[model samples]
Target: MAWVYLIIAGIFEIGWAIALKYTEGFSRPWPTVFFGVSMTLSVWMLALALKTIPVGTGYAIWTGIGAAGTAILGMILFGESHDGWRLFSIALIVIGIVALKISSS
Candidate 1:
């Protein structure tokens, strides 16, 4: 289903984002390869999702998932701040995403 593809793409968005950090400005060979692969797969899956999903809604959801997930991972994996405001913002994004999905039906 298109939703499935979108979700998978969002997950890969997270992967590539984290992997990007490990790339060390793309100087690291292995992480660079990982970033490239992850980025490619992420985009491909998103495109597949677009076959069934409307471009506007799908794009907003995809980027919302990617941004929120990446921000959360940054706090957990990296030494990014885990402030209340940050968590609250992430929660807002998630809530908005849920609203979008619910309204899309």
Candidate 2:
């Protein structure tokens, strides 16, 4: 259950991050609202997960998911770099996230 919350939180972290680009510095009304909602949910879910998960492990995994996911979305959605090294870096982050989960268990 806690893991589920953490995963959801991480996903929302990615959602808010991607939505940030669309927010256009908070000038866009709809995207700004979406960003705010996603951010709130992300934090709330993190809090729930933290009730059981260690802070260090939980936080690192959450941010790792967010960072890797946002980077992938940036490349796919916004024409950001898709270089081999960049992809490899993202894969490493994912590997770290998986390792953390396994260690925590």
Candidate 3:
């Protein structure tokens, strides 16, 4: 289904985002390659999902997944932050994503 592709694409977006951080400004070979590949796949999947889903709603949900996942992973894996406000903001993004999905259906 299109929703499945969208979710997978969003997860790949998180992967590419983290891989980009490891790329060291494209200086590193493997991480850079990973980022490139992941980014391509993510975009490809997003486009595929867009064939069925409304652009505005689908894109918003995709970004919401990527942003929230990236922030949470940054805190857990990269040492970005554990701030309450940051967590709250991520929660809000999640809530918004859910609301959008519910409204779309």
| TM-score on alpha carbons, each prediction | 0.97, 0.99, 0.98
Candidates, ranked, lDDT: 2, 3, 1
- What tens digits encode model 2's per-residue C-alpha lDDT throughout 10-29? 99999999999999999999
Candidate 3 Cα outliers beyond 4 Å, as residue runs: none
Q: Give the range where candidate 1 is weakest over 10 consecutive residues by summed lDDT.
A: 96-105
Better of 1 and 2 by lDDT: 2
lDDT of each: 0.93, 0.98, 0.96
> How far is 51's C-alpha from truth in model 2 (Å)?
0.5
Q: State the lDDT of candidate 1 residue by residue for 1-105, as single tens digits.
A: 999999999999989999999999999999999999989999999999999888988998999999999999998898799899989999999998898888888
Show pairs that collide, candidate 3.
none
- TM-score of candidate 1 to 2 decimals: 0.97
Better of 1 and 3 by TM-score: 3
TM-score of 2: 0.99
User: How well is each residue in 3-98 modelled by candidate 3, as lDDT tens digits?
Assistant: 999999999999999999999999999999999999999999999999999999999999999999999999999899889999999999999999
Tell me how candidate 3 scores on lDDT: 0.96
Positional deviation of 99 in candidate 1, in angstroms? Answer: 0.9
35 in model 1: Cα distance from truth in Å?
A: 0.4
